[model samples]
Target: MAIGGNPVFRGKNFRSAVATAPPVPQAPYGQNPYGQYGQPAGQSGYGQNPYGQNPYGQPSAQPQGQQMTPEQLDQMYKAPSAGPVETGRMTYDDVIMKTLACLGLVVLGAGVTLFVSPAASLGLMVLGAIGGLILALVNSFKREPSPALILAYAALEGLFLGGLTRIIDAFAPGAGFQAVLGTVVVAGVTLALYKSGKVRATPGLAKFFLIAIVGYLAFSLVNLGLVLFGVVDSPWGMRGIEIMGIPLGVIVGLFAVVLAAIALIFDFNSIEEGVRAGAPRRFAWTAAFGLTVTLVWLYTEILRLIAIFNSND
Candidate 1:
């Protein structure tokens, strides 16, 4: 007797048969309902979407530079899809570590310059400026950060800064230390202001800062030309010229300290973005490089400021 129609034997036999027979198919394990295949799952379908859609269920992308949804365009234009956005791994400790490394190089180069020839130091300085500039441009444009290049830039800038410090120190023994202290104070205060939102990097401020920087650059070029042509006998050429008994260098240097402080704010902003965007660990070096550049600029200006003040006094 069959299980449906019979009694004792029927139930037992039917149960055994049902148990022995292959199990009726289940939705293929983890198979997508919209998938193309009726095939039992655990198999790839046309377009390879398991659940009748892409892995992430995103529709295939259109051509590049074409119109896209706001979200899509943002994804395309923003930093590459490396990982989740991050924030605040860049602490004062990180900055200090990097700054210490840069300063070590500064010390090394300065030691050499002090014991060796100024010409040797000057030659190295020119080399450093050139090398640092090239690497800076290269790193800025790269899709990924390069630690080697970044560290190289640091070393090069250190050589240049150290050599220049020695030259100026010949005239002013404690000026290097003074400039260093001044740079630290300026950077510290600027960072505090930026972090506290006391000194915001508003768009208007950025625009003004850019204009000032460009003007400073133009003035520097003119002054350099004047010095090279023997038109100016002063140490800083036209930059050292006096207006109302005040060296023009003093005014320019003040503006530069301010500019460099603003630049530090920009560096902070960039590092904030990089960390927030989950940029790679190596990018820490990029942050370090930028900080180094700003500090160097700050120190140079501070040194000049002191010199002008002393000369005037």
Candidate 2:
């Protein structure tokens, strides 16, 4: 994620949340840093040949002279062969690979829910939520990452997503497919816009995001209280209430998309940082895990929005 402010916005990887700048490559193994190449035993500099050829300069010797001295030739041969060039740490390619892995887990989990019985599906969902929560907390707090826990989270999340989608699809034809498509379209558009520099979560915007998330959470808590106290009777609880001709769900759904998309930016930022920091190759799974969480949130929000829109139609 991009750093929002010096550290606050950027600290959480606000999508600018955690990506670091480029990384330095580690030196390769077994190569003699002290001796290899044509120079003197302990010679530190690739100093000029008695004739003043440049040291760090690697251009071929000028062919102006008909013959070369043996000393010059040996020095040229001794200079260490240029080490391999290092590309900046992580890249877009890694993101693609990790994204695919995340999607695969999602599919596997979904399968478990769709074909299994209701009792089984319910049990899977419970397990998925609890396991996913535990993994997320562990990864967020641990000094080092645990690959197994991360993967487990993905698998459990898949079950949760699949079961939730199944429940929605039952009441609304093609709801699951629609939500998936909606999620893809939103993700594609967001990525394009971010790459093009058209959409940015600037410092000011991030402050607003924080404020909005807090407000939304407060509203949700209050709404839940109302439902429990018999103050609201709608299926969506407060979300099913209409405000001046507009359903509350639509209003909240739109807001949810913004929040979720920002979360995606945070996910993207983390992936970018992993690559730049040359974070352990295994951390790539953490990148995938973050993305899966955001995408699931985005998909569920879109599904809710569609359902709300259809209510009036």
Best prediction by TM-score: 2
Q: Ten residues in a row with the worst lDDT in model 1?
A: 1-10
Question: Cα lDDT of all candidates, in order?
Answer: 0.64, 0.67
Ten contiguous residues with the weakest lDDT in model 2: 5-14
Model 1 residue 165 lDDT? 80
What value of lDDT does candidate 2 attain over all alpha carbons? 0.67
CA displacement after TM-score superposition, residue 170 of candidate 1 (Å):
1.3
Model 1 Cα lDDT, one tens digit per residue, 1-313:
1111111111222233323433323345654343433322465432333344445657645443333355653453443322232432334456567757866775675566667687888998888889878876776556555667767777787777778887777877788889888988998898889799887656677678778888999998998999999998886798777899778888888888888887777766655554444444444555666677677778878987887777666
Residue 45: error of model 1 in Å? 27
Off by over 4 Å in 1: 1-99
Q: List, residue by residue over 156-240, the lDDT tens digit for candidate 2.
A: 8888878877777776878888888889988888888877877775667668777888898798899889888888777577888
Give me candidate 1's TM-score against the actual structure.
0.67
